[model samples]
Every structure is written in structure tokens, then in C-alpha cells.
Target: MRLTSSLLGIFLALAALSNLRQASAEVGDDEGVSFFIPSGHDTATNEDVYDLLRCARALRDEGTKSDGASKAVASAIAAAVATLPPIQLAHTDHTLHQVPERARAYLPAAIDLLARIRSFAIAPPCLDRPGIPTTTAGPYKYLIAANLVNCEAIMPYWILEVLRLGLLLSGNSMVLAGFSQNVANAQGSASADGYLPHISVYESGSKDNTVPWLLVAEQLWGAAGMRTFVVVNGSLTRQMVTDPFSGKYHKQHRIQFLASVRNAALEPLYGAPPGTYDNVVFVNDVFFCAADLFRLTHLKADIACGLDFEVWVGHKKGHMSGITQRNFDQRRRRRRLQSSSGASNAADASTADLTLHTSINQMSDVHLDELVRQMAAEGRIRNAPVKIKYNFYDTWVSRDISGKQFVSDVPYISDRRTRDILSKGMPVPVKCCWNGAVIINAAPLVNGLRFRSGISEKGECDSSECSLLCQDYRRVGATRVVVDPSVRVAYVPWSKSFHGSLSVGVGPRVPWSQVQRSGALQELEAIWNDTKRDMATDCIPLGTRSEEADLEKVRSVDLRLVNYTQMFLEDRRQPSQQPTVPRLCNLLMGPYGVVDYGTAFDDLRFAALGKNTITALTYTANSTVNSLQFTYGSGSGNVTATVHGRPFGNHSSVVFQPGEHITHGVVYYDSDGVIKLVLTTNKQRNTTIGGRTFSTNMLESGKIHQAVATPCPNDLAYAGRFRLIAIAGTSDIRIRSISFLWTKIGGKV
Candidate 1:
């Protein structure tokens, strides 16, 4: 809320500098080419047209050397200009590739046609909309057209388009969005360009939120490297579930900080800075981490100017408000639910609903929490690192055959809700036509708080519609919600850590000289189970209140949850140990053992200790060499192997087990070159690799591993250590007789 006068001075000075850059227009400077079209009216003169023409020429020339995608964009622009009626330029719906058939051929000739337009010197700056001024004024009036027909908001659309094109050509798929009207240069320093800003953020209709964007200018004053900025309107308030900053300060501050943090992470590309390389983040303590930005960011631009005269064409309709609002509400509600549940807030259950309906009710809850949510001023002190995962599915088909019967008659609606919601604001839904699109939204249910949508009779649902209704009933700062066309949700599993673990075994195992039917493969499986079972027993039980303080701290900070489940797999493929007499085998297997270890399974029977419960994990590997196998059997029946089929190959695969513990089983190992296994578990508070500590469930339990009874504690034996097991038959063979190493020998058992 407080800003230094010196900072303010810097802001004003930057504004002036930007204004001066355009001062050439008044002085009859006609050297630059313009991208804008000029007005023929008497108020507009040839001088303006000339300036615009110069700017356009300059831009075209800039792109002249562009290759691949960039060249394609420029060529498309050129082609569109040559054949499409000048009036057709007003149609917002037309992308460069969507021009008339005759215009298609003109694309190759576009560059030359554009060059001619630039020659006019008095050409008008291209006008995308009315009112907003272009970078330079002239034939291309410098006005930006909205994304919708007859709309007037400018700047965002044009800037975004340019950035989008640049990104395409650069091959950076990461969607970098800008906010506000300031331009941060390639050197990281920022300066206000022009006030052609359509986005206005007001704390209380007094101070503009745009002031914070200037923070980038100050922070990057002397830094170097690519600086990105994104400006979006729909206030980044708590009302919209997609807001990255929905805490105390304001959405503006949150986005500013988000950008700064992301820039810091990306700065590695520019080389590290001097000391500590703090690379100060200007978020004002609101948003933190790139994950937040990635999860909540949204992009929108006005498009009316492009379709000014094409109103009659349904294809050129604006974004629908009904659909937009619906999507916004649903997203906001989900956010509240996630925050409350993740943070374990003690607020009354009804408070979430009240928050959800804040805007609709026009109620005020501007307390610190509410303020933080609205202005995006909250710090990392009250947030969690939210993990978002995206899943893609065909709308016409369901994974379940039962759901398929209703697909045709059900009017499958993947983005129909988005259409319905946006219908309130725009003339049409831009999303209805997309397939293979990615839809990003809040996770379905967070803790007890959830954002549930109304299901249709045929099991169809409309998230956009439900969101709109919910948001319409709430009172918050944001006007509308942001919904990603991408069909990905911010996934927050009931369990934070994953069970899939990779163990890297380094010790030696049985060799293939002395042969048996099953060989040492069974022993290999036992060692793996010993490592896993020990890990499971030693971990804190799920849902227990152990280490509450540590958990609180984790919850309060935005630290990413680490899952070191692949270390074992990577360690196996590491360069082979120097071959030696008694060889690597002497180091792994016990002294008098001739173990022919291959692969084996196990179903170790164990009882739950203290509060600890049984945790089942399956290990998989792929290589030319053999490893171990595990199986369980009783006095009355055949021993059942804990694992099924071969686990390791080329692709990722999941290992499944019935429960935490089984009746009886055994394990075996081969000690061959291969040891790449994907092990998954269901035991709460139990996650480890080769018996080494990786991650433990937040819950607390008092269980200890059965391996602890041995001299080599499970923790110490599996701690980044594994053995190579070789299997021959049902017997164990020592490595003393084998001549070949693991990788050199490959054959199917």
C-alpha cells in the first residue's frame, strides 16, 4: 500500500520517456513504417499516414530475415493484405490462415505487397480498435482491434499476438503472459511504453494497481536478459478461481511477484548474477513460485475492431458472457475449497460458501485474508505448493463402455459449459470448436470443501454453467473467471506423495555358475522386499499428527514436494563396477553362497506394528541382465509371487498389490545387469528407495521394520545400496565361474 516517492518519480519519468518515443509523429517524422491504417477524415492528415507506414515498414523489415514459423507468420500477414478486401480486415474472426481462397496464393507475395504499403510513407497505422493509439500514428492508425466484433479494448490482444508469434518462432511452448502497460526490455530493465492500457486495477477506485507493474522497472533497472510482461483485465481477484494471487494484497501484486519469481528461475539461461544472486522478486510478497503462476494464469484480449462491420456473420461473434461467468464462478469456488482444505484452515464451513457468493451478494469481507485474496498481496506464509496435472480425453468416447452408450444421444459436452457461460458476455463461444484442447481448472474436491457441478440425466456435466451460477452468487473483486481451454485440472491427491519408488542397488549378488531350477532370483526379490518393508515400517503413519510443526512449515511455504523414486533405477544403469577377481560378486553375496540369481517375487507376511500399517510396493526393471524375484507360499499351497510379469522394459509401468500385507511369499534375485524397476505402494506414511529415506507421509505411526532385528538395519543396508543378482535355475550360483559381465550377456529366460 505504501510506495516511496523516488519510486514514483521513476515511474513518472519512464512514462515520459515512452511518450517522447512517439513524439516523432508531431514532428513530421516519416522514416518509420507503421502497422496501423490511417483515417481519410480531414482530422487525420498525410503526416499521420506516413508515420504509420514507416512503422509498418520497419516491422516488416524486422521480420524479413525471420525463418520457419516467424517467416510463415509474416508471409501470412502479407498474403492477407493483398487479396482480402480492405473492409474484410475488420473481421475479428479471421486469422492469417483463414483468409479467402484467392488470398491463399497471395501469402507468398505478402511480403512484397507489405513493402509497397510501407513505401507510401503516409500509410495509416493498422487500427485493431478505436480510441487506443498505436505505437506510432499514420496510415495504420496504430489502433488495435479487439478479439471480438465491435469491441474496443486494445493493447493486450496485439502485444499478446506479437509475443505468441515470437514464441512460436522461438520454439518455446511455455505460455508467457504479460500484464499491465509497461515494457521490460531484453536487458530486464522496464520502462512504461504508452498508456494505451485497457486494463485498470483499483484498490478502492482511487489508487491504480498498475503502479506495481512499475516495480519490474526498478528491480530490473540494471539486470540483463529477456524480460516478459503480461497485461490482463478481469481482476485477479479471489472471485475468479483461476487467479494466481487471491490473497491479501491484490491480484496485481500477485502477478507481479509471480512474473519476478519465474524470471528468477529462468535467469539461469542468462547466467547467474553477482552475490547470492537473489535476483529480487517484485511480487510485493503476494504470489510466489512458478507453479502458482502456471496453475492460475489466464489470457484474454479484445477483438471488436477486427469485426466492426462483420456483426451479421455469426462466425464473427464476440465471446459469450453466460459461458464466461459460469466458468469463472465454478473455478473460484474450487479455489476456495482447495485453499481451505490444504491449509487446514479453522474457518467455519459456511464461510467458503459466503466467500463463493461474495460478488453476487455484494458483501465485504476485506479482512487480511480477503484482502490478500483480492489484491494478491498474501505471502508464501499461508499457501501450499499446488501440483496441477493435465489429462486429455476424447469427448465423444468414454473410458467405460457403459458411458459410451450415452455418448451420441447425450450431446457430449466437453467445453459446452464454457460456451454457455461465455454466452452472457460475448456473441459466441470460441471454445466450442476445439478438439485436443487443454482445459485447466481447479481440482475436483479439496478436503471437505468442493466445487460440485450439476450432472445432466445422461451423466453429462456443465462445469462452465455451474461455475457461472456459483460465481454470480458470490461477492468478490474480480468481474469474471478465467477458464483454460486445456482439459487439465489442478490435481491435489488425498495423498501428497506417490508410491512409485525406484531403488538403486549397489552391492553384489548371486552369480550364475552353480545352477538350480529357480536360482538366486528369489533371494534378489527378498532383498528388495526387505528394503521396502523396512522403509514402510519406519515411516510416519498416514493421518497421524507426528511432526506437526514440520508439516505446518511445509504448508506455509511453497516448497515443491520431492519424490526421489527413480534414484534406484538410474543407479542400476550406472557404469559397471571394475571387473575383478572374486569380482563384483565377492562384494555382494555372503561368503559361502553359489547363488544362480535371476528374478523372483515375494508376499512377505507381516503384522502391523504400533500405529503402522502394511504398505505394498511393486518393483519393476528392464535390462539385458537378470535381477530378483519374490513370491509367497504357505504350507498347504504353492508360493504366490508378489509381482506379475517382467516389470522393466522401455516404457513406464505401474506395479500393483492387493493390500499392505499378504499370507506368505518369497523373493529371489539374479544379479544380472538389469535392475530398472518401477515400484508402487499403498502404505500410508511409507515411501522410500532401497530402504533409504525419500519422503514420508505427514501422518505419524510407531511401527518398526522386521529387518531392524538383523545386524544390518534395513535403513543402513538399503541406504543407497543395492546388489546385482544372477539367476540360473532353482539353485544359487557364485560369480567365480562366469566369464562375461551383465551388459555383455543378454538372453530371455
Candidate 2:
């Protein structure tokens, strides 16, 4: 894709615009983004106009790559981009009636242009982008805008595009979300105000296409009539350290540079004018989107945030398929414009997919990009909620409101009140959080606050710059900082979709009150009454560092489980003879293998929770829990028993007392599957199952979560909350995993 004569001319003009913008040497070479007002001479000539239109025509190829109606489009507009304009014209009105034939060319474009913009130098930017949603609930009756958009610590360009589309799409999403939030706005359908963020990037020591892509993005944004600033501190030296004139650092310099890179991203905010922008969103190298930007902007807090997750499969090339199954609750979704008809707010929930194709785990960039695009087009990535699976990666930066650090496992928020609030889909207050992305009010920063290093003299631990920003926020009376559990992000785009990603509404803030039931609010007295505070490690400890590289042995999840098994052993009655038994809803858990994408029988429930007293447990074990069967006691006594795995090896039964039940249990196994299981009863009765002999590798295994209730990936229960029932794992001959299902006997936690 070499630059043509026209595109080469665009390069020259774009280079000129770049020079006019804060130049390469405009700031300290050591750090900081180039932030400066555009000059009067930053205008394109008539030649560059044609090149833009040509590039746009090329980009908007709807099907197999071919030239679109570029010539006609260029002819239609009389030098629209050749010269700058003074007064911008208004677009079409919000009407249920049909649009007039005359105004069709720029009806929606004008509408978007009038909101939060003067002009894109000559015309609205990026006409090649997917057209704006034709119909909406109404118009932009409310004004929601962010003049500054911030990004830091980036990797590949595909991940970057996810955010780019997010910032670009925020213009309309904010308006739509706003109208939905305000009763008057939706009713009035008043067309006014929108979003247009000045995207800024700060990168350091990257050996990839990030900088080139960013440079091109600047050109694209400039054509859109928006401002962009990019600064890449790329240097050839990898091992160069020992403070060489503040220019290059790495390795031993890794710890020092582990930091400065973050602070560098904040440099642009330092010299901005007060009230210039409503919010400044700071995102790390995590996957995010336009929906993310829209959700973060609407939160009622001084700082609103989203968390990140990381997952990797120990995959070897074996025709491994995509995620077999994941489910979600049904809800109203704003689908794109229907054919001829307006956009429909489709109502249906798509199960969030972890579609990191195991077979293609080591795929090339182009192939991966194709997969990413295909999956991204589906509903899976758009509305999936966030939840911790193995590790909540940002433990160091994320802290409870009381400044206590979170755990390293799933359901990371340990504070019951905080967890309850988060579980209820509210923005729970936090001392600080930088899980992945955060939307912050730059009013304090514009006033004096800065993202800086820790001060040892102030007793602050050497922590992230985000912690320091929160500390400054507290000092400036901007302490309503919270993390929305719905807004989820991950290191890989194929990972979890953010939490709080739904039809954007201005939901109430973290409601602190009396907690007696579900969605109960916690009391805010402790937060309000106490005043004195100090910077400590408990609140701002170390940044999260995942051990996937070192602790690879403990990490094992069967990505091949394809059967979406949901069944019941009995419908509160034995089908063969008994009148009534427990209504058991069994589900699949752990790395349990599924066969042929179908369950063995119609009444199959793989992983189920029950408090029923197991009168007897039988097993045929060679080494692992090879084949197992169990019977529960009732008024009629032990009636029928259920069996899992093969009926081979030495058989034995461990009977329980009258009132004994499994309080908690532990399963020890490996790639060979369920090797052994020990159920701990309420009366300290321990029933051990499986063979006495096993290897060392299987000993150091993961635990089956005790507080797990829901089958949904995003929703999880708490520890000591749900009791284990009957585990119906081992569907296939090669059952390689087992996890304790910790759910209530009859309901979800």
C-alpha cells in the first residue's frame, strides 16, 4: 500500500499540520505528550481535499475491495474541504416523518456537526466511517462532551482501533445515552450538543507499528476537523540504563520506566485550561470501545472506572475450536439501523463469549485481526458483563473505599458492603482503582493536581501514578471515586467485555444506607464522619503483576467444553417410583470435558449444589475418582443413586450420620482429571474418595470455588456462602477436571 501522488500530497499537508501542532522538539524529550493549540496557518489546499475524499472512498468499501462513488461524491460538494468556514449550518430536525429529498446528502452529517463542533476545518471528519444510527429515541436534547481523550501503554494496532472507534462513536452514543437519561431530553428530542474528544497518546520504547498507526490516526482525525497529539519515546537501546540524560532506559531501568511512561500520558492535562473539558478518560493497554467511553462519561462521580482481566491457554495446535458455550440474561439492546427502517433497539441477551480460539492461539496478526473483527461484530463483545475468573490483575492499584487491598482471586472485592453494591450493578465507592480504564474530572488537574511519582518522605509506597492522582483528588474535595463492575476490560481483546456495558442510563451513585436484603445499600457514616487521612500502602500498594509466566502449572481450563448441559436428576420426585425428591438443577464446572456437544441424557445436570444428606458414597478407583455413585437419605430412606465415570476398579462406600452434610470440599487432580476429592462435613466428618496413590504434579492443583452459584461467567458467589451439593462431572471417557459448585440448595447467591 504505497502512497500515491495524491496521497503523497496528503502526507506533505499532514506533515505540515503535524509541524503546526506541538512539534517533535516542542516539549522535554524525556517525557510528556505534545499539547498545543492549532495555528491559523493549519489549513489544507484544494489538492489535499481530493486526496482525502479518495482515501475515504477506498476505506468505505462495503464489500470485496473496490472503488466506491468517490468521483460523484467529490463532484457533489463544491470545495467543501478546500476552504475553512465561518458559520456552520444546522442538520435535519428529529421527525418521525420522511426526510426531504433535498437535504438527504448531509442530513445526519449536519446534525452531528452542529453538536459539540465548529467544523472539521472544512467539513465533518471521516465521512467514510459507518454512517450514524439513522433513527434514535430523539435528538441531542442534552450536551455531553469530552474535549480531551487520553491513552497510555499501548501494544498492537487492532487493540488501538477498538478505542479509536469508541472515541469516534462517543459523539452520538453520549447524545443518545443523555436523551435516554433525561426525561425532558427524550421528550423534547431537542437537537443540540454532542461529544468530540481531542485524542492524545503517549508511548515509550515500542518496537512495532504503534507510532506509525498513531501518526496516520492524526491525519485521519485532522481531516475530521479534530485535534490530536502523539508522542512516542521510542529508542533503539533496550539495555541502556543508569540515567543517561533522561532519554533512554530499560531492563534495570524497567522499574523506573515501569512508571514514567504513565506519568508521561498525563503531561498534556497539566497545562490545559480549566473547564475546557468535562472529563478526561485515561486507558491503559486494555481492550475497550465506544460503548465504554459512553458508559464512563455518564457515571455520577469525581472518578468513574472499569477493571481489566488477563487469561492465556496452554494451547498446542490441535484443531481446537472456539468457546463452546457462555450465557447472558436477556435485555433491550440498541441494534444498528434496520434495512430501510430506522435502527431498532433489539431486546435479547447474548452470552458473553471467551472466543480466544485455542487452535489459533499462536495466530499471526492478520489472521488474528480477522478473527477479532468477526467476533467484534457479534453481540458478545458489546454487552458482556465483567467478573474475575482466576486473577483480578490490578490488585496493587485497586483498593476498597477504606483503603484496603483486594484479594488476588475472583470476586476480588472482599468488603461485603462494597461487593454487595458492585453485585447490584452500582458504582461502588473506592479509595482508588485503575483496573484498565478510568474517566476522571480534570478540573483538579487543570487546577494543580498531577500524575507523579511517590514521595518516600510522605510515607507513600512506590506505587502507580493513578494512586497519586486519587490522593490528589481527595485533597481537592473530588472524592466520589468508584469502579463500575459492569465496565470490564482485558489485556487481550478476545477476553472479557467490560461491566456496566448496557443501554447507557444515568444510574444513581453508590447508594450507602441500611443493608438488610438483596441490592441493599451500605451506610456512609464511616466515610462522612472521618476526615483525617494519610497516604499508606494498604490503600496504594504495588501495581498488579500477573504470574502466568512463572506459575503456568496452576493454570488449567479446558477450552474444549462444548456441551451446554442443563438438566435435573429429579423434579422433586423420582421418575421411576418415589413421589418426591429434591428439585436439582445440575450445571457443569471446572475443566470438565463434554462429549459430542451433547449431554448423555435429557435429564442431565452436570454440576449441582445440594444440602441433602448423602447416606452413602460409592467409588471404583484405580488412581483418580475413576467412577463414582452416591445416594441421598430421605423419609423413605436411600432410594436411588446417581453414577458418574466408569464402573471399574475397587468399590467402596462412605456413609454419613443423620444430620451430616458437606460444608466445604476439596478436589485434587491434574491433566488426568479428578484424581481425589475430600468432602468436609459439618460435624468434622471427612469422607475421602479416589485412589490412595497419585503423582506429585496432580497434588499442586487449583481449588473448586465454594461461593459459586450462577452458571453465568460474569456472575459469581462468595466464599463460605454456597454449600456443595452433588457434582455430576466426568461426562466423557477422559474427564480431566472437577470444581466444587458452591451454591445454595435451592437458589442463586
Tens-digit lDDT track for model 1 on 1-749?
12243653455345434433333232232112110112111121234233323333333333433343233333344222222211112121223333334323324333222222222111111111111111211111011111111111111112222222222212221111121012121111112112111111111111332223222211111011113332222121211111111212212222222222222222222232332111111111110111112211212111000000001112222121121110113344335333423232212221222221222111111111112221111111112132211122122211111111111111222234323322221112221111211111211111111112222222222222222122211111111123222111111110111111101111111111121133332432343233221111001111223311121221111001221112212222231322233412222122111111111111122111111222223343333212233332233333323222223333332232433322111121122222122122223222222222212331122111111111122234332122111211111111111111011011111
Tens digits of per-residue lDDT for model 2 on 503-617?
A: 1221222212112232322333344234225333253333334311122222221111211111111211111111121334233334342211111210112221242445667
Give me the overall lDDT of model 2. Answer: 0.38
What TM-score would every model get versus the actual structure? 0.18, 0.41
Give the whole-model CA lDDT for all candidates, comma-separated.
Answer: 0.21, 0.38
lDDT (0-100) at residue 528 of candidate 1?
28
Query: The CA-based lDDT of model 1 is what?
Result: 0.21
What's model 1's TM-score?
Answer: 0.18
| Residue 392 shift from truth in candidate 2, angstroms | 1.8
